[model samples]
Target: MRHAVVIIHGIGEQKPMDTLRGFVSSVTRNQGTDGKNIEFYSKPDELSNLFELRRLTTASAEDEGRVKTDFFEYYWAYNVRDTKVQQVLTWIWQILFRWPWSLPKRIRPFHIAIWFIIFASLALILSGYDIPFMGEDQPMWIGAIGTLLTAMLSYLFTGYVGDAARYTSPSPGNIAERQKIRKDGIMLLKSLHESNKYEKIILVGHSLGAIIGYDIIRNLWSEYNTKYVDGKYKDQLLKFEKDYAQPENVALNIKPYQSAQEDLLYQQNDGGNPWRITHFITLGSPLTHASFLLAKNISELKERMKERELPKSPPVFEVIKNINRFTYLPDFKKPGRVLHHSAPFACTQWINVYYENDYVGGNLSEYFGKGIREHKIKIKGSPWLRFVPFLSHTHYWSDDGNLKRCEASLAILTSIIWDKKMPEKDEKEKQTVQPDANELAGLEL
Candidate 1:
């Protein structure tokens, strides 16, 4: 069976296939001296239909019935257009104007440097003596430097930061922008599923793309939530969920939870269900600060989750026995239990990886759910460097010689994407996903 890797890129003026190419390059090049020699081939992107957006197809071991993966990018930067300076200004007002006490605790310390930058920029702008090419009092060198700095800042504010501001804002225009992105994402997934080529779809979202990925899964799962085939094998999956929903078992290991999720996913597929996305992996994701980015506070974020607007890991469980966080539709044509709209994570396992020093990414299990396997790692740094950012967000993969954190991150990713082979009826399958140790072992935070 072939697997599809749909990677959603972060903010910025990212072109089609820009992220997928870089990501595929890193994944392939870092396979270590041991492991399968995977080769990548550029194939036609059927979904995008754009020459710039080619699919990265890897040569898989089809002879041995080994699952191969195809990588596709969900490019949505085109939807965020005509980003006005007013949008950035408004977002700055919303974020910089807030007091430390009002900000979320996790994001509070991170905003100190942001506040300093804001004040420093204001000081420079308000100071008439520091005018760029507009004022006569400024020296030629000062004016030249000021003009260059203006151009740089303009690009940063409009292109890079504008994406987050436009998407996260609740304004009517922002809502429309978000809707378009989500609709396009849903369409892409639907097309992939309908193609009937992939048995599984793995979503890898980086930075702001993580937020988009979460929205896509939460929304798309509703279309297939109630779908089921008549079968007597549903009780096992149901019992697993019921037992997992207990308060005592809330702090359980993620491996067992992930394994159960993988089982339930294939069961749905075997029963003719169309939902095939089994794993969602986020790297350097900003969703770690949901309260600051998505809502006003922590209470509102949890409220949204409880209201079924946001999907949670170990989804919101009910006290009822048979309908443990699921909808029991007795009046349907063929009566069976169906997953609730907010229970996408009940089947799709969320695996988040972030550098310890990355200000944008942090532990998400506390906010999203307990079932999320949040891996905090350190990459090419001294132990005391955890307090610094040092552009760690951009260096998730091993771009340099340091494969310390990259190995650990790739281990989790490879383990999930490669997946475990299914057992046959005659004899139990002993084949397991054994990625190279050199490619999958490293220090953890």
Candidate 2:
């Protein structure tokens, strides 16, 4: 069976294929499958017609470890239209002005640097330090320097942060663009499912793309969850989610649940179900701070989860035949149950990888749900630099990190993407973050 991975690039003015190529290079280069190096051949992107898009094919591990796979990218930066610096600034202002109690304790340390940047910018303006090279002696050069600086700031704020500001805020002005982004994404996945060329598909997202990926799957799952084959309905797959995925099951380890999800996928497929998305992989996802990105506060965030607006891990459950499940009856005559609106997660596994120094990311198990497999890795950085925001955001794909994570981000991806155990490395190299059983306890203010 062939596996397909659709990687979504994070924030910034990312070009088509850029993120995909970098990601493929990293994962394939550091493949932990056996001791043999994997070879990738450029293939025609049967997944997309666009010439800018690409597909990389790799043979499976000789030991039948990782299966033959095709890697694809869903580039959405161009879809995020009409981004404004003001919108970015407004979002930042709203975040910065929130009450201290509203901030997630673990995330507060990262904010210290951002606050410093903001204050320094304000101080520079108040002290008349306009541009780096703008001296009183160069009065005529003032216009040139100012123009140059304005363009740079515009690129940084609008070109990058603009994507996050618009999609996340969901103001009246942003709704159309946001909807368009999600619609295009859903259409892409729908196309893949319709193609019927692959047996399994993996959705991978990085940075802002992580949050976007989460939104895509939860929304996309609804279109297919009910379609289970005739014999698969009211089955164990749905039962596993209900019994073990409760939002309150804090101490629950999701490894077993992940295995059960794969089994359910295989059952559905054998029964002729076409929905083949098996796992979701997020790298440096800001969904960690979903309270600010998705709602006004933590309370509202939980309310959103309860209301089924946001999909939670294990998913929300209701009493069904004396068994708690995340399903509802769509047709009483049929006698089978349809997954609830937020139950797409019931059958899908979520793996989140974050750099310890990247303040933008965190363990989703803390806030989203414990079913999410969280790996907090560390990159090479000064002791004091580990607390900086955005410092390690772009290094997720870099092979040059301390890799104090469960393993290399590549190793983590290899294991989850292939649904196999970590490579047979020595125990000393398997540096991993200990699981913290705390609730969103300090996740949000």
Candidate 3:
């Protein structure tokens, strides 16, 4: 069987090949698979002329079948082009007003105390000169030089921070970008269908990319249902067959009911959509933040609010409760009534993997209902540790110690990717795998 896998990168400045190469290399190496068997391509001919992609074709280590994976970078960093000075101001505003980082309220006093200490030290350095904010007359160069230096440093750090905030937020600007990402994903899937004879489609997204993947899959599923499974074209199909029947065989051939009934049975028993997604995998995804991200859409927000009976923004709890999961048709007393059921299995199976120390990761099974599964890998620190979010968030694809440490968890992901079934765990279910920090701390693509 042939398979097409689409991988989407999370927040930050991303290069197509850079992200793909790192991920594929790391996963394969950790799985004890040979990287030499894989072929990588940049800007493959299968996609749109203007669209960029990093494509790879590799034989599955567990099977004789071959798999092709495409990496999509929905890079939004290019949209931001603030001047150095502007970036400095934006950084100040975000730090003071937005306070993007999550920290314990108990530690707030210490942070404030540290701020005062820094301020006092700076004042002491320029003692003889009066600071304007302090009601002292100081040389213009003192302030000018300080401002310029701050701006320069901010400019250097502006690219990732600013775009990450925008990409993760539910503000108007970010919503527009989200829509564009979803539309582009749809186009890519369409192109893949026209160009290849793939039997399975799998979508994998990391971090914020996972949320984007959800939007794309939801939209495509809706489109597929509308076009094929809704019974809208049944009349047209029967009409065409009736009109084409010969006079002598008209009575016998007019058995359009039997033909249509068989066709409907085929659709219901098997997956009705030819281009359906077989699986959706999310790595270290902050999908629990969906409510916060969708706050800007009033119509959708209103529906969510109404469903949850909430007066204000839908909380994470409410959003999770409202999540719609795919399910197979329930059993009925009469087999004939079930014969025309359109979907025999869930539209897609969701597999989510996250490290315990990752702040952005949450159990998505609670949201997507029965079809979703969550796997938590052990990390060095408390999963909710506040200070090291950056490190924990980005190292999910490390090739060495961390990957090896979480071997059991990674096995689940590898099983899905290689089209193999995972071995059943023991009743107690505890396994020992230790992640090495040195190998995972600085991953290079």
TM-score to native of every candidate shown: 0.85, 0.82, 0.58
Weakest lDDT window of 10 consecutive positions for candidate 1: 425-434
RMSD of 2: 8.1
Per lDDT, the best of the predicted structures is 1
Candidate 2 Cα lDDT to native: 0.74
Q: What is the C-alpha RMSD of each candidate to the true structure, in Å?
A: 7.7, 8.1, 16.1
* Candidate 3 C-alpha lDDT tens digits along 277-356: 66678888876444334443335554654453321100112112232211212233212111111221133556778876
Model 1: which residue pairs collide?
Answer: none
The digit string of per-residue lDDT tens for model 2 on 218-318 reads 88887887676364434444455444745483577666777666665655555556787878889988888888888899999989888888887778776
Best-matching candidate per TM-score: 1
Judged by lDDT relative to the true structure, which candidate is superior, 1 or 2? 1
Candidate 3: misplaced stretches above 4 Å? Answer: 30-45, 48-52, 60-157, 168-176, 230-271, 296-345, 366-370, 380-387, 399-402, 405-409, 421-445
Q: For model 2, what is the error of residue 440's alpha carbon versus the real structure, in angstroms, after optimal superposition? A: 33
Sort all candidates by TM-score, best to worst.
Answer: 1, 2, 3
lDDT of 1 by residue, 121-166 (tens): 8898788554445566656898788789988888888898999999
Q: Report how far residue 117 has shifted in candidate 1, in Å.
A: 6.9
